[model samples]
Target: MSLTRLLPILGWARRYDRDDLRPDLAAGLTIGAMLVPQGMAYALLAGLPPEVGLYASIVPVLVYALFGTSRQLAVGPVAIVSLLTASALSPLFEQGSAGYISAAALLALMVGAVHLVLGFGRLGFVVNFLSHSVLVGFTAAAAIIIGFSQVKHLFGITTERKDHFYETVEEVVRQIDGTNGTTLVLGVASIALLVLMKKFVPRVPGALVLVIASILAVELFDLTDRGVKTVGEIPSSLPAFGLPDFDTGTMGSLIGTAFVITLVGFMESIAVAKVYARRHRYDVDANQELIGLGASNVASGLFGGYPVTGGFSRTAVNDTAGARTPLASIVTAILILLTVLFLTPLFSSLPNAALGAIIIVAVINLIDIGEMRHIAHVKRSDLIGLSVAFVATLVLGIELGILVAVVASMLVVFARMSKPHSAVLGQIPGTTSYRNVERFPEASVTDGVRVVRIDAALSFVNAQHVKKLLLGEADAISGGDVTALVVDCSGINDIDATGVEALSEILVELDERQVDIHLCDVKGPVRDVLRRSGLWDRLDGRIHATAAMAVDAVTHPGTLPESLRSLGIDERHDERPADTVDTEVSHA
Candidate 1:
């Protein structure tokens, strides 16, 4: 690999245009202002101190600017990754304890290590196993869980964290009467302010506005005395570089969580990156992205921060604010570094209720009811997978929930492949083209000939299924007197040993029944497999270039159609040896 490929900034930095500076600066400032509240809020969501979020926003953003492929993806503490961090670590230690914080940082390191290994190994395609349905369902469920997990902060009530979402809901309901009037009012007002600003003046950073107003309200009115919780005394210095304690047992326990975070974080980051890359008409290398994100997470871990990834909302804001390159991310990181160094005191009086409100508002859109409805209309099987994932995530904890979601997605895939679509084909009038007879009722079939197509690669899992479907189609023809069967191999791109064996069996059965079997449009790979299996020699004179040619051979006997003659085939072609004659026919 080249130096420029290893460090993406090396490629883009040389071409850095001065004209982009103004817009990059503006976008950086905009996101930096927005990240102030969001980073802190997401940190609290992850069960970490607010300063850790600031720490993450700084180092991760800068690291991604150096290694990341996207020009505008602003990397930082995202809500989903934060929630996963908490889910992974909360069982091992008390939330926000020194040990818990260290474990969180270690998790970031482990996640980054996994990403780097996958990137180097060129295994980035492994994430394809996480199908869209699974992501949608898991994201919606996690959003709900994250939203409700903030109720205690929002209402200023004391409640123990529960393992399951329903337990949390029940605890919230049981403690509803203990809600602090002051805190509830502030949180509700904060939510209202965020909503209004988003609707009316989306260009402004609403979270920042809410954070400032809430801090002023708490400080001016002495709200803490009335039981309004505030983000007390954040350290007013930049995070010092350090390595997390790597206890073997803790590392072993965290490996699974780190893997989950690695996949989920990269999926979220790449999804947004691809969207922006397409809009800008640029390319994003997936493996290179893994390396970038891996480096960013490693930086976060070393700098006293938790795991981070590309957040969709922030990336959208970055793009809309006119970020043309990763230079904008570096600028944002600098702004965050300044906040850590000089502006930490301003947030000391910030209300926890305001942060809770911000988190709730941010995650509510992730429910994605519109996407679920669209999935139901477009592919109900996928809806089943989505529903399974949603219910599993809610019933099981987030860690096991994701495992179940992946399994459900795989099962859905296997189910589809095992029973893939197959159709009886018929020739359209006045054309050599063939189509599904069921779809095109006007298309007519030739007497004593059966044409069938299976729209999936043949494998052990579906070989028997295809064999039965093909034979059934041959038998179901009117009068059941089929003299010839034409297998359309256009859709069969590949075949395994079991598939070749199944075809051999079908050929034998057809021969016993006195029906000639012909294969047409056989893909080169499938043909090679058949030849190696010694089936190609048995299929010698039966294979043709197209279904139309096969049908004409059986129907017209010694005469060649004008269309076939136009392709330069002579009348005496069939008189040649089977190998020579087959070689003479066009495979196009």
Candidate 2:
């Protein structure tokens, strides 16, 4: 492994030129503007002091810039991870207490450790198990919950937060009559202003605009005296480095939460990195990205911050702001550091409702309704998986919802694979090409040859189904047992011992019925397995390279030419009379 691979900053820094710095500076300032309001809002969302979010936005951005792979990715606190942080720690400690803050920092450390280990171990591919359907469902549900969880802040009313989504919403609604008039107005107006500005003047940072405007309004008009809650005091100093709690009792309690945070945070970061990398035509190393994110989280935790990830919204802002490199992130970190040092007092008047509005607007984008509808239109099973994830997250907590989503996705996959698609293939008329007989009605089938195509990898999970489907097709024939059964293994990418056993049983059954079972288009690995299992010997010269040759050899015996036969094509025409094909079956 090269040093550049481990420290991605070295790769770009060696080629850094004056031309890149200007854009990086401009983009950095813009991202820093967005991050200030968002960081504080996300910290509140995580049930922590607002400055912790600022603390997170600073060190993580710098760490990721030094070690991360994607040039354009902006790493910091993200909504989903913040919600997860709150969810994970709320039950274990009192919200915003010293114990809660320590737990959050510890969670970040554990999450960082998990990422570092996975990256160093080169186990990045493990994330592939988190199917898109599961993510889609889980994100949409989490977004809704996060949005509703802020409703109390939006209305300026106190309500007990419930674990269940509907219960939380119900409690919020039950307190509707207690809504503070000034807070509601501020929240609603901030949301409207954000929407309008994004529509009409998108180049401007709307959250910054809202935050600044809200702060000015509150301070100028004495809104705090009007029953409007402000953010109060924020420590006007850069984060101080500190070690996280490492006590076995404290750390053990947070291990499970940390694991979930690791998965969610890395998933979010790598996804953003890949998206921007594709646009810039550069490839991102997932494992390297894991190490980068792990380092960022560790840095954040050590510097009095919670777990953070690459946020999609801020990264988009960075890209649109014309950022050319990760230098933009470094500059952004500096600007955030400045904000903590000098600008903290100005934001003391920033209303909680306004920050709540910012969070609401940001998280609203996470709900991918269009994706749900598309999934529903395409695959019912995927839609079910998506639905299961959404509902589970809404009813159960984040951890259980994710658990349900993963299980539901796996179950859906296994259900489809358990009875894998098998088709009866026939040669397209006047062509060497063969297709599903039912799909291509014009195709022709040989009288004595039954060509069955198994459309999935043959594993223990589906071996029995394939065997039964093949036997059932043979039995369905009206005439005496087919003289030859040609099993097309074109789509069978792999075969295990159970699959070989299933084939052995099929061969015996066909032989008892006076049918010669021949295999065609058997993939190399599968053939190797069959040979090792001794099924190849039982095949007795019945395995052909192609379905056409197998059929030709079965129907016309020696008429298949050597070259065409070697390529799995039947050189000879079908000489059997049409009426002799009493059972020319073809179905998808």
The TM-score leader among the candidates is 1
Of candidate 1, the 10-residue stretch with the lowest lDDT total is: 564-573
User: Candidates' lDDT values, in order?
Assistant: 0.89, 0.86
Tens digits of lDDT, candidate 2, 1-588: 798888989989999988988999999999999999999999999999999999999998999998898888888898889998888788778888988898888888888999999999999987776777788889999998888888888889998867788888889889999999999998899999999998999889999999999999998999999899988999998898998767787787778778787777778778888899999999999999999999999998899999988988888989999898999999999999999999899999999999999999998888988978887788867887788888999999788898888888888889888998888888998787779989999888877678889899999999888888888877654443247788888999999889888888998898787778888887778867886899876774577777876777676554323232335332334344565433422111
Clashes of each: 0, 0
Question: Cα deviation of 454 in candidate 2 (Å)?
Answer: 0.4
Give the TM-score comparing model 1 with the true structure, all chains together. Answer: 0.95
Model 1 stretches with alpha carbons more than 4 Å out: 478-482, 557-588
Candidate 2, residue 218: lDDT? 96
* Cα RMSD for candidates in order: 3.2, 5.7
lDDT of 1: 0.89
| Candidate 1: tens digits of C-alpha lDDT, residues 1-588 | 898999989989999999999999999999999998999999999999999999999988999999999998989999889999998898899999999999999999999999999998899999988888889999999999999999899899989888999999999999999999999999899999999999999999999999889999998999999999898999988888999999999999999999999888899999999999999999999999999999999999999998999999999999999999999999999999999889999999999999999999999988999989988898888987798889999999788898999998998888889988878889999899989999999998988898988889999989999989878776765543347888888889999999988998998877777778888888778877887999877876566778898787766554223242344222223343343333343334
Q: 421, model 2: CA deviation in Å? A: 1.2
**Candidate 2 accuracy as lDDT:** 0.86
